[model samples]
Target: MSLGTLGRYELIREIARSNDIVYEAWDPQLDRRVALKELRLPDGISDKDKHARKERFKREARAAGRLEHPNIVSIYEVGEENGRSYIVMEYLEGETLRQRMDREGKITPEDAVKIFDQVLDGLAFAHENGVVHRDIKPENIQLLPDGRVVITDFGIARLQFEPSITVDGQIFGTPSYMSPEQVVGRDVDPRTDVWSCGVVLYEMLSGQKPFTGDTVVTISHRILHAEPAEIDGVPWAIAHVVRKAISKDPDDRYSSAKELKAALNDALQGALTDSMGPPSPWGPPLDPYSAQSPYTYGTSQPPGTGAPSPPPPPGGYAPTGASPYGQPYGASFPPNMPMPPFPPGWVNPPKRPLLSPEASEFLLRTLIVVLIGGVLLATAVGTIAWLDRRSQEATAAKVDQALADEIAKVERLIPSDPLAAQQQLTELRRRAQSHATRERIERLLSRAYLERARRLLDAGTTDETLRQAAGLAQRAAEMAGEDGQATLDAGKLLYDIATRTTDPQDRFDRLTEASKALEVAFNSEGQVRSEAGTLLGNTCLQIALLFGDNKARSSLYLNRGIYYAEQVGNRKLADDLRSRL
Candidate 1:
């Protein structure tokens, strides 16, 4: 059977081919280069298995499509036509971390921290949204040319969907990086990401994986019980963090990606600061960025062993005036030749004085006095400068404290009176002048409005109150600047407005605003796409559930909802909605 094209997408060069699927194609119509994965059905595979595989493929595509993060590869479309299944994903240009490690041996500690941070950030976002990335290994992580790190291959990721497929004791991850629990076929959580990250860190620093054996079972056993070798001679702080991350027990590891990221940041900071100091022979070797070339001033070697040959004496022979000890004759002699010393205290000649003794004494005293005065003046000036800086810091701190206090007060008042709280927040906004101060104030105000709006909607308050809340949320979104939290809060408020209303025109208008707000939130720096996707899907579902006639439109919304929900691993909700169909 001939496979028809998907929309305006055109098949491009095949970038990658695997046993299970072939990835190719780009969509110029959408201004995106996509990877089209066409699964190969093996001979003798039953129709039941084929249908399951197709559903699974579609589910994976939808789930991956919902995740919008710089560190996660995106899926654009998943469809089937004429017995062929296809999934379109973002075309990324970069070598896999596995390939990089193989080529570069070991990554520098600084680069390791940076790369791990990106991984953690992505994982943290996914974990928070209830998505569990079951398979995380070096091969799945792409290192982009611009130094960005992205995790790929969520084909076997766990999402919130029904009839959760269980391989029944089959291991899912690479043996080298798999957590002990994963190896034992036990349930896992965000900490699994932490454990895998530790393995990557260990490999990056040590130029070797933490665990290895002749067989997969041996490796699995080592992962379960063995302690990794001491990472001496490597960067210390990084080694420490990596050790904790790769702890055999999940409880011994970082509880979340955020915690791991913080640890990595601390390690990086310590490494940088330690590198700025004088080198110590007992400590780890200094980074290249530190003072002095390691090649020139490093630890001294033992006598006569591998020492550079002493430069040949000036003309390959000792100089005539040279002493037996290699010192030049007369080198220690005074510049001016002096007569042989006479008897002690013997007077030779008299010289005329330029000034009177009393005058000279007075001038010396004045010079000494002036030097003392200069020292005192310098000390006073330095003290004044330090005091001024301290004063400024104190003032900034006070302003920050005041703003925080007011924000807390407003937050506490949100559930009681949203408009009154908003009015108070507006006053706080007027008082904040500096960009930093205004940004903080606006974030708090946005959160307040969002919480109040959600609460009011849940309480079944007047539609007018909801409208006001939405307006407040929009205002907050405009003022939020780059804070992802504020943008998300505003989007949520707008979404609440859209869902709580029954009027078709009003609901449509609110949803349009909600979509725009969510789009803004999704595009904002540091914002995760999982939450936004869920909200978007829910909005679409609400529209269909409250207005649409046939099951077709509702099913479409449901399908999209399941896709996004699964992408982020909101399985319970996704399963429930899928069951409704």
Candidate 2:
């Protein structure tokens, strides 16, 4: 049977179907061929829920579509009807990494390195665009006939710059390559993608996966506790990259994808011959199914060797979503995170219903108790519940306030004692009581990093150091999110890095990130707004000049920047911005 049309595309045939259906379709509007992905959804959902999901799907699709990189598949459109949603994207002639692995077993180290580099380049670009492919597995990575790799399927991709909150304890991604934090249900960031990439690297280099078990429980246990099996003949630099990328603690991993790729390049170029050492390891070696790592919060292992010294206390980190708790259904508390304030011998809280709907109704219907008795009982119950809620709120407020105070201390120390502030913030994060608190702490810590990056850029003369500073600023920007003061500061720092860097493409990418950050900061006043406007305008001018592909789009940015400069009463900057326009 012929597949029907979805929106304006004629679905020629069903290409594939799993959780979603893919149809090779013709886009009449564009006179082009496109792959249509149809995601199935259950009926009977609330309209609100359905609408929210569709919006999220479209937003993610739009974000992915905006990315223009050689190794990324292009997205065109998204639509939803009835209970199904569809996305139109560029159709490619190639196989997935899973198919390649199945046919060839494992890849050669040389080919693997090249493939890894290409993937990282795409990922680095995506990260720059504030996009994170939460799921980066072999099956999701497509390979072209010419040996070019394209990162596809941004279904679960999240915008890194958007503030995300967790309402339902939910997490996503495949189990086999899940990072340790992912296994335990901790909040994830781009570094989580770094961990998954390490798993891919290991699998490509060695025919077998790093961790395995008979069941999801066992697999999760291994992922949390087991060290990756060593691959013989791995040069020190390659080994170093692998080790650092897969580090159990996110803190131990490279700060950014650019840094990870830099490590790979340094190893490939023999720059690491004089300085190849251990990094964060699969927390001390354990039996593959042991379910526990040797290192604990008290351990003092070397950096990257195992869980390092706990960093400073928590700050203003917060993320909100229905994002899964980083763990699977049966998984337990993740390693490295601070345990809740349970009593020494506390077991699981007893599951008991406080008040079922039936009881309330029965009470209402009971006659004699209805008058004075019902009134008294209802008042008592309501008062008790209110007191309990107020008490809980008060306690949480105190904890959050304390965390805020600690973060303020870190901020004070950033300019004068960055390392100490960093160390202190790291420790505080471990102590942070909730996911939102941890996210806030991460953002505050990134600011401390920004402060250090500024100093390094000011003082350093080495390309490596400059890159490192850029990486730090990126971490700050990614964690602090896409708006307000931190992002603006990060934009300025990235702008500085761009001016200093000589590589044309890298310079362009950095400038692009800078402009994005500055645009978000355009609403502010004083030097920041003026600086952001001028920088954004200049950056846009450079992108348009160098790329020359989308002058119209570039003109949009140039105009906005000029307007921002004019708003700030900076006539000189406004005039300069107009030159770009």
Weakest ten-residue segment in model 1 by summed lDDT: 343-352
lDDT of 2 by residue, 63-118 (tens): 68879998888887878665568898999888999899999987876677788788
The alpha-carbon lDDT assigned to residue 26 of candidate 1 equals 44
lDDT by residue (tens digit), candidate 1, 458-538: 776577877776676667666666666566677687776776776777786666566556655555443356687677667
Point to the candidate with the largest lDDT. 2
Off-target runs (Cα >4 Å) in candidate 1 are 1-8, 160-163, 275-581
Superposed by TM-score, candidate 2 places the C-alpha of residue 127 at a distance from the truth, in angstroms, of 1.0
Task: List the global CA lDDT of all models.
Answer: 0.70, 0.72
Instruction: Assess candidate 2 and give its TM-score to the true structure.
Output: 0.46
